[model samples]
Target chain A: MSNLSKPIPPAGDQDALEVEIRGKTFRGADGDAVRAIDEIAFSVAPGSFATLIGPSGCGKTTTLRIILGLDREFDGRLKLPAGGGRIAAVFQEPRLLPWRTVEENVRLALSDEDTGRDLDDLFAVLGLAEMRSRYPGELSLGLARRAALARAFAIRPSLLVLDEPFVSLDEQTASRLRTLLTDVWSARPTTALMVTHNLREAVQLSDRIIFLTERPARMRGVYDITTPRADRDARWREATLPALAKRYSGVL
Target chain B: MAPDHRADATDTALLQRPAALGRPVFGPRLVTALSLAGLLALWWIAAIVADSRVLPAPPAVAEAFWRDAATGELFFHLAMTLMRVIAAFVLAMAIGSVIGIVLGMNREANRFFDPWLILFLNIPALVVIVLAYIWFGLNEAAAIGAIAVNKIPNVVVTMREGARTLDRDLEEMASVYRFSAGRTLRHVVLPQLQPYFAAASRTGISLIWKIALVVELLGRSNGVGFQINLYFQLFDVAAILAYTLAFVAVMLTIEFLLVQPFEAHSTRWRPRRAGS
Candidate 1:
């Protein structure tokens, strides 16, 4: 159901490769240093969806920030593919410019040539076409989140990083947005990495799930969901998924 | 999501409703006219009770005003006073805004000017006017300069605060979008700076008028303050009362016609929260 009008290069054809993090430690204030993501070595395959799940303060956000070049002081070597295209992030908050209209907020992320996508269609996909002229203050929380999603997708980034993107959304809106996000990723197939506390969301959205241990996080487990793309139905409620949930519940 | 359909429907219905009737057009004007009438009545009553040349009745003040108007003397002096005040205010705004913006951007410059600006703010207007007259020999230049200098400190303080509170997020957005300096100034900076500018103008206008009056009384040959001085020398209480009432009327008109409208326009974007 993707409505991308123009041909976008495959994630592989663009700069598709792996991001490796080696022994990253982040120190908080009060002179107490926590070795967040110690000796964490993982590779994000191009055109694959990966989800990082762990307890709160388990270095999920820190890992994502390190990959995004936002946290450079960490002791790690992050190997990104050559000639990285636009890297756009969907923050936990919508972070839409309060003064701009919804349409303008989405348009702000796009270059001149990338504006070829039908804005009306994009908004319609997110159920936001009618609210295009409304400011962020005028929009409901769901619509604002949809606007933020549309903005992230509008830029067509090679790497799409989401940090608890749907934390505060109601279940129905969150589910709808999750479906829309899957459809968008399936179309363009960007190297997507999302960090979530919800195991159900991780199972539903990710090709590979990486679970982390408590504070000074380490990769406790990795689950490769072998479910075929077409046959995965109610993936979170599947019989085998519970076993995996029971297996990783303690680390979380 | 089950959209808050009920709330949306109510908002839409509110938007569709016919506009409310316009406000009563003459309410404020009527209130002002009545208040002025009350003040005149009080003056007349006081004059009748005092029964001396120290206080003049409304009719006596009116006669004095009419005599001056007929001779074109009142208009000439009023015009001269207004011209000096306007010139001084303009110069103060220009110089103060420039200095304030520079100081706001540079911490070192702000520190350098902090003591000096505080000194200017604290000095009495009458003392400054006397000093200007003594230093510059009672010329028009000296009169206007004194008023301008007295007004600049207030404008500088206001503009500096405005610059300090500017949103860094908005600036970053502008930078990411590669907006030119002119566009950034026009759209982002100026809109944010509007409240400060409006405040500066309001305070500056009132101050310019007060300082201009002091300068005229001390040194200048023409203007309302000079005419008041002349009336005092002749012991003409009626003339003095008429001139004072006329200046108050001018100040009130400026407040209503210019400052109020500008303030409303500039702050329209600010949201009104509940209980505000």
Candidate 2:
């Protein structure tokens, strides 16, 4: 069991987000009360990458939804950064409007003031420059996911939430996209909290990994990967993953 | 193998075969021309055989059409009927789409109004027209109102189904991005409902035009329907057929030039099928 201590941020960055969820319950179709999240309390330091790791049926996504304000039924308090920072998310599915072109879909996410950001650079980074006029139905799953990522980052969101964005893709495509995700995040790093089940991905992409127990999930443990992102090469991952896996064997 | 029929065919004859797989030898345009010509030939044959006052020959009908066009009476009646169609169609589509979206989104309202929708749907157009005339007294407003009333329930039924099937995921995305209500409706909601709007309009045009004629026949005096009625009373079958064909031609033109092209444009994002 992890204690409820807010992590210290680096100098000059103090507006870390604190999420405290006492309980979350859902009523099944049969009208029985089912607890989805027993309790989850964690703080994501500003500019830090945090990944929520848990089993499939565990309530990782439920917690993410609550924090994103998509579901308000849970008992929780999410203290966003001062000045009410903007939040954006990439859902499990791409969720792009099928009728609109890719450019339009991304443009819809931007507020009027967001026009100052150079969308062309974002498109170039995601390799979606030529795909701006295409419809979502015309793209493959991987390309559609790339478009979804572009929409999320186009807003320059302060809190970027990703809900299993790269799930179900082939290994090659998924790996390529992970590299792109890190590149975009580094270009304009924000406080990001991603929900994924892949432990290796968590090790590669996150500064901190929050482990949760299975259904009616609770924070089981927290691991800090102090290794800088650039040095987490294949050889480093080969050595570090098994040690972390053995330490948090139950949650992993 | 059977003899290669393509080797002997002319270039123009071979034009239709390779462009579309599994299509008939004749192109669609050519088939449409043939079908219309066939109907004309059948009518000509029937006129020759009967040689009666009711069954006029092709030339007689054509002469009546030309006479009406020459006097500009055809244009007058045709314009009057077209105005009514446009007015009633716009009114019914506007009011019905709003009501349908509201009902579809609200369970309580839908339940309360379900019986009313059923009643309106079951009521015959004639009864509505008669009631409107009796209450409002025979006039353009009453006539157009009655036509719209008959068509509103149909648009409501279609738009309600459309609203019910809107994608929830996309809606959530819109809200999460803080899109304004107007923006959400324009980009997220309207695109999803377009096919249903097209469906309602296609059926609305056909249904409203038929009811418009009835309204004119019962009360109004300036439309093509009135002309047909007057010809019927005088036992001038050729004149009646001429007016009927003229109005039908206009409706067909609207269907092709407006309704169908809009439908194709709306669904252009979908993958193409073999024939469509």
User: How many backbone clashes does every candidate have?
Assistant: 0, 0
Give fnat of each prediction, in order: 0.00, 0.59
Model 1 lDDT, residue B184, Cα: 67
lDDT for A103 (candidate 1) = 88
Best by DockQ: 2
Compose the digit string of candidate 1's lDDT tens values, residues B1-276. 112223334434434444353323444556568888898789788889999998878899999999999999998988899899889999999999888877877799999989999999999988888888899888988888899989989999999998888877566445434345775676667777787888899878987897788789888788999999999999999999888778877887888788777776666444444221
Once fitted onto the true fold, the runs of candidate 2 whose alpha carbons sit more than 4 angstroms away are A1-14, A115-117, A250-252, B1-23, B273-276
Tens digits of per-residue lDDT for model 2, A1-252: 011022323324647778899899999999999899998899888888999999997999998888778899878788875336678889999999898899989988888655455689999999999999999999999999999999998876778899998899999999999999999998878889999999989999999999998889998899988999999999999998889889888544
Provide the overall lDDT of each model, using Cα atoms, as 2-decimal numbers. Answer: 0.77, 0.87
Candidate 1 lDDT over residue span A1-252, tens digit each = 122344565556655446556566656687777677675666667778888888999889888777766667776566554365566677777766665678877876676555555677678877887988887877777777788888877776667788898898889988888888887678667778899998878878888888888767877888887775556676535875679868987533
Q: Which model scores highest in lDDT?
A: 2
* Global fold similarity of model 2 (TM-score): 0.92
* Interface DockQ per candidate: 0.13, 0.64
**Model 1, backbone clash pairs (residues 3+ apart or across chains), number:** 0
Where does model 1 exceed 4 Å of error?
A: A1-8, A16-50, A59-85, A104-118, A155-159, A183-192, A207-232, A235-244, A250-252, B1-37, B52-54, B58-117, B126-149, B159-201, B215-254, B271-276
